[model samples]
Target chain A: MNIVVIDYGMGNIRSIQSSLLYLGVKSVIVSSDRNDILKADKIILPGVGAFGEAVREIKKRNLEKHLAEAVLKDGKPILGICLGMQLLGLSSEEGGFNKGLNFVNGVVTKLYGEGIKIPHVGFNQIQVNENSRLYNGLNSEPDFYFTHSFKMTSEDDIGASHCVYGSRFVASFENNNVAGVQFHPELSQNNGLRLLKNFIERF
Target chain B: MLRKRIIFTLIHSDGYFMQSRNFRLQKVGNLLWLEKNYKFQHISFSLDELIILDATRNQKNLSQFASIVSGVVNDVFIPVAAGGGIRSLADADLLFKSGADKIVLNSLQYENPLIVRELVEKYGSQSIIASVDYKSTAEGHLVYVNDGSKKIEYSLKEYLTYLEDLGVGEIYLNSIDKDGTGFGYDLETILNVKDLLSIPLIIAGGAGNEKHLLEGLKTDGIAAVATANLFNFIGDGLPNARNHIISLGENIANWNANS
Candidate 1:
């Protein structure tokens, strides 16, 4: 499959590409080029930096418009990780009030509660949605590696897998071919690898 | 619940991975020897995270070190944080481009905090880890930098606060006295200073067995336990330790059969 990772000179495209390589996806491309996005069989939006800066880079490379066309219009499956997931939402509170692609009906906000840590960094358990394509065939409360400050939540049915850090936040969300996970599946051992495999096969 | 972590640390100096004892590095073996025996690729499945520190004492050739890091972490699908002698963003850039999910900072944390701030701004706080090596002296817990050679003025508590204010994601607190000793972690010191910062803390140095690891993880506020002692936990040592911890009901990650 032609899996093109959207690299706007900001995301950690290496680990995502390697994870796909390990999962037996032979043809993977890490590019922000319009042609690569247009021709991609699937797009993986992997990010490791800030939301505001990431949006700037995406717009700078013209990935914003092309990605919208490829995913929204063409209906190509896309998986967004961490900040990439947040960028798929409407807005976030991190790195100043930021805007996103609005492909999914969600809004990013800082996860807060009494005695809860910021940038919840570690392997946290996720309670996947009943019919999540991203979390298909997973055991209950499966663990995934999370390292971020802001999380997305929406009143709309986005088919989210919830993880409680300080409070309940969207660990992952799937709406048809559009998918996003706040945790780093590339870093989260076997369960993560399985999730990626599911994305490649089921999505 | 967020599960605690078991991290395997690889200490590289000159051209080989070394076993560190009280900051004195003993050359263990080359990458080939490590692969043949330890089988990090196999054992890493049981580990939650991996930290590769370049302890080259001399003026560090960053390209050579980055190459080593890239080679070591090619297949390990875990959070890999690499650092040691990183002075500029270019050096960090090389490491991250190679495969590092997070860039570790030590001397730069105290020597050049502005650059550290810039890294935090660019990579976000979650992408930077502040590594503090402290020696329990007569005065108290003292912080060290420059490959644990030069002692700094700030105490452990003071230094951590500085790092927390500076906005590094996590803390890798290593005991210089307990490193590679195989005795145990400095639990007294860990307990004494665990509440100083709000960030997740990964305690390293002197984890001899699975129980030592369990003791560190069981301690309140300790997020992860790391060991750089090669001979102590070589080959099946790590996998055994992980199973022991999980069987006892500690919250380390457990992969299924197909996984």
Candidate 2:
């Protein structure tokens, strides 16, 4: 399959590429070209860094429209990791309340609570929903690596998986062809690889 | 619940991975030796994270180190943090491009606070790890930089606060006195300074066995425990220790690799 990792120039894209290679994915392309997105069998939107800068790069590279077309119109299976996940939401309060792709109904904000830490790092377990396509074939309460200050949440269902850091928030969500995880599945162990395989095969 | 992490740190010097002790280094093997003996992929199943440091004592070439880092990181699906002589944003960027999930900063944290801030601004705090090496002296716990050779004036606690203020995502507190000694973690000192910062703190040095890992994991306020002792945790040593620690009811995450 032609799996394209959307390169917005702000992601740890190598790890995702390497992980896909380990899963026996052949013909993987890392590109910002719109034609690459148009030709991909699956789309992996991986990102790291601030929301404002990421949005700026995506706009500068003109990936926003192509990404929206592929995931929304073409109905290509798309998975967003960490900051990429936050970008799939409705809006984020990270850097002056910038807008997201609005692929899913959610809002992103700083993770804060009574006595909880910021920039939650390390491996943390997520409570999966019963009908989660992203978590298919994985064991219960699987742990995934997380390193971010902001998290996404919504009043809607959105096929959400929950993790409790400060309070309960969205760990991952799957909405038909669109899916996003607030953790690094590429860096996460077998559970993560299983999730990625599910995205490639089942999604 | 957020599980505590077990990180296996590989100390590299001049194109060879070494066994570090008391701030001194002893070459153990090269990359071929590590993969041939340990099968890093198999051993990685026993770990939540991995840290590779370039203790190259002389002028270090980051691109070469980055290529080595890229070599070790393939097929090992865990977070790898690499650094030692990262003097600029370009150096840190090189490591990240070569497959490092996070950049570990030491002397850069002290000598170049502005560059550290720049890294934090660009990568955000979560991508930067501040590595503070301290030796408990009669004067007090004093900070050391430049591969544990030069001593800085900031007290241990004082320096930690400064790193946090610089918006570092995590603190890698390695005890120069206890590093690779096989004794145990400096729990007393850990307890004293553990509560000072609200961010995640990974305590390293002197973890010889599963019990040592358990002791550190079982403690309060520590997010992770790291060991760079090659002799102690090579071969099946890491997997065995991880199993033993988990069976003892420690909170380290269990992997489903090759299951």
The DockQ values of the predictions, listed in order, are: 0.70, 0.70
| TM-score for all models, in order of appearance | 0.98, 0.98
True contacts kept of each: 0.59, 0.63
TM-score of chain A of each: 0.97, 0.98
Which consecutive 10 residues in model 2 chain B have the weakest lDDT in total? B250-259
The residue-by-residue lDDT of candidate 2 on B173-204, one tens digit each, is 99999999999999988998988897899999
Give the C-alpha miss distance for residue A64 in model 1, angstroms: 1.0
Q: Which stretches of candidate 1 lie over 4 Å from their true place?
A: B257-259
Query: What's the lDDT for residue B256 in model 1?
Result: 62
Candidate 2 chain A minimal-lDDT segment of 10 residues? A114-123
Per-candidate interface C-alpha RMSD?
A: 1.4, 1.6
Q: Candidate 1's residue-wise lDDT over B110-223, tens digit each?
A: 999999999998899999989999999889999999988999999889999999999999999999999999999999999998898788899998889888998998888888
DockQ of 1: 0.70
The residue pairs found clashing in candidate 2 are: none
